[model samples]
Target: MSLGDENDGGQTRTRLPDGGTGDVYGGARRPARNSRSLITVVGVVVLLIAAIAFANRSGTGEGTSDDTAKGPGAGAPTSATGVRPVTGKDGTIPTGYAHDEQGAQSAAANYAVALGSDGMFKRDTRHTIVRAVHDPAVVDSLLASLDQAYSGTFLKNVGLNEDGSSPEGLTFVSRTVPVGTKVTGFEGDTATIEVWCTGLVGLAGEGSNKPVTETWFTITQKLKWTQSDWKIQSSSQQEGPTPVNGDNRASTADEIAGAVAGYGGFTYAR
Candidate 1:
């Protein structure tokens, strides 16, 4: 994530620094009027919406349609995995992916998770990830470019130390949660997959200018079956099918940081 895409020179979504700009979501901005009236209007709208949905379903041949979009289902248990998860790893990345569709999907999903993680900000882990997940042909160039992208200026822009470390009193947070992955194109030796993801980025601490925030995105990876496992030949990303924000109570910085530290991240597999 520290490395912006070579194909396009824009900032990487997960790695972009949020230099204490406050909540990008307008968190500090107050509504001009009380939302009680808006809530009443929304309540009426919900009932009408529910009625319309029920009528549409009743008119349809079945309760569902195959043409409907496949929403996020990455964590759903389609069935049980008869085969065991990969036991082999190249550095910290899973390796020895099966040479099949399922294996390719598994590889792509896990790679997205790794590349979008907070660890990508650090030098050593970033190198390990690039070496392990990227095709050997592009690994060296990627390392050099990524090193430049994560320069002191970029780190300062995102509220990190010159060396990409968090400040002494703050906890930096970056995480990627894959919602689902599907193959867009595939051949015996090559595959292209899209991984839908939701991510958290920013710092969590009292009076933090950049409060932990969330964003949605999709990553497309072109993978090749090399060395008996899938390796990314190239990858790109775009903004996503982001849902509207909900009315959930925002947690305090200490609460957010504690939850992150206490709850460990998963090593994703499809």
Candidate 2:
């Protein structure tokens, strides 16, 4: 790798680029000869040619391509697995997700919606959901912890009765809409997923003290593939990757309650 060195005034001088030479004894410089300048130019052209040739060799043929390359749908704003959604349900919780990454993602998304629904406020429905979606080994402990967490004070704060029911002529509303899901980890039988969601909660009716309001959050769940499907092993939630509020006018309580009664929720899948 020796390119040789130039001698200038008894001191070694590295050749300057582009026909420039300098004798740095005390600061007197001279331009290089035309022949040396031509040599430098030729060397630069050779290097460029070599680089281009190497790049061409490493690339695909002009007409050849990766036929299996996927498109942007994989990371698009709204995407689907294109597989049929799960139809099976254990009580109200969706079940029988696929045994792969997509399945894990679907299970997590659906579980987030279920856990954030109005049903979870009530003791009976909460128990049913816990048993259906969670692993059997953790169900009892999870139920006990959840019961303590959803105390009477918490229920009243959300405009629910002491028993997690709505008062007469008032409607209790809690709904979660998953914005997206991501599978952060996956292995043979275990997976971790995070679901980003927007939720609506509070009372909606005439003279209601609490009007329906929206919030954003993310739920992360560790899942185990059991019984040919994904079941939640453990889960934790945190406040969201929330977006700024939009300019839409707020709906009246009666309108919100009417919409909730009129519309039905969808079963989500990846």
Task: Give me the candidate number with maximum TM-score.
Answer: 1
Question: What C-alpha lDDT do the candidate models reach, one value each?
Answer: 0.59, 0.55
Structural similarity to truth (TM-score) of each candidate: 0.74, 0.69
In model 2, the runs with Cα more than 4 Å from the true position are 1-77
Q: Write model 1 residue lDDT over 136-248, tens digit each, in one string.
A: 98788777777766678766666789887998778888777766666677778987766667777778776667667766667767789887778887776665667777766
Instruction: Assess candidate 2 and give its lDDT.
Output: 0.55
Please write out the lDDT profile of model 2 over residues 1-270, one tens digit for every residue.
011111111111111123122211121222222224221211211110010000000021233323211321222234444345667788766677767666677777777667666777788988887777777876776677567756797566555788989989877776677677666777769877666666665666776655555555666667888877788776655555677666555666567778989987654534
What is the Å distance of residue 41 in model 1 from its true position?
40
Mark the regions of model 1 whose C-alpha exceeds 4 Å error after superposition: 1-82
Q: What is the clash tally of candidate 2?
A: 1
